[model samples]
Target: MSSFLGRGWSFPPRFDPRTKEAVMVADETDIAESLHILFSTNPGERVMLPNYGCDLRRMVFEEANEQTVTEIKELMRKAILFYEPRIVLNRIEAQLVDPLNGKLEIALDYTVRGTNSRHNLVYPFYLHQATHPVRA
Candidate 1:
């Protein structure tokens, strides 16, 4: 977690394969619910709120510790590029595990959607050393 705490974050190129100018985040309802919870927990960080189209602006969130600022900003840029979503919901969930070692972890989930879609797409990711996070 220390490694993740200080590094800049980025996703590889070719994140989306769709050609319609928009891509739904995912088809999972539970993921949507989780994203809702994450958003509700942090409202100020939501730089781009959803609307009716794909021409949405990117958003960035500054972490409390300021250590993951680069990672959070990168998250915003990637969300904009991959989904071109109407909104960018940025959130950080943190918990303390070992006080002696100062081991903590943060989770970031972005809810992005395509135009003319019925459901929202939830792309969730968490950071940890040696384990890849899941996103769609």
Candidate 2:
């Protein structure tokens, strides 16, 4: 039953040094990695599955205020609900890290369906000006 939590290519798609094959991730790591991809990708970014990802980019130009935070939370919920079925999402907290620059941190609380293992994942969402480089 828990095997339904699948195995997939590692995020950033690295290769094994010895075998020169693509690295893979399994179980909870795979799920977490997939979530990272989901949050990073924009909906319609994929040609084959046009709606496969989260649409956080839709609000790229929106102010990182409460309303934008709420909408982003909904986007996360929708993406997880539609694309990932291995876990049940319990709560999502989208907090503004820096509103002026459009940075947000989304915290997710979820449980795996088969074994009831609890997990927490924090996904960082940001826009182009979200951070400032320090100059000494």
User: Judged by TM-score, which candidate is best?
Assistant: 2
Residue-wise lDDT of candidate 2 within 3-105, one digit each (tens)?
6789999987889999999999888988988888887777788999998998766677677678888888998899999988988999999888786766777
lDDT of each: 0.36, 0.82
Clashing pairs in 1: none
Off by over 4 Å in 1: 1-65, 84-128, 133-136
Give the lowest summed-lDDT range of ten residues in model 1.
4-13
lDDT of 1 by residue, 21-135 (tens): 3323333333344333332233344457443222111212222234553444454344444433343545545444443433334344444343223443433323333322344
Which lDDT value does model 2 have at 8?
90
**C-alpha TM-scores of all predictions:** 0.26, 0.87
Taking all chains together, the TM-score of candidate 2 against the true structure is 0.87
* Residue 98 in candidate 2, Cα distance off native in Å: 2.9
Off by over 4 Å in 2: 127-136
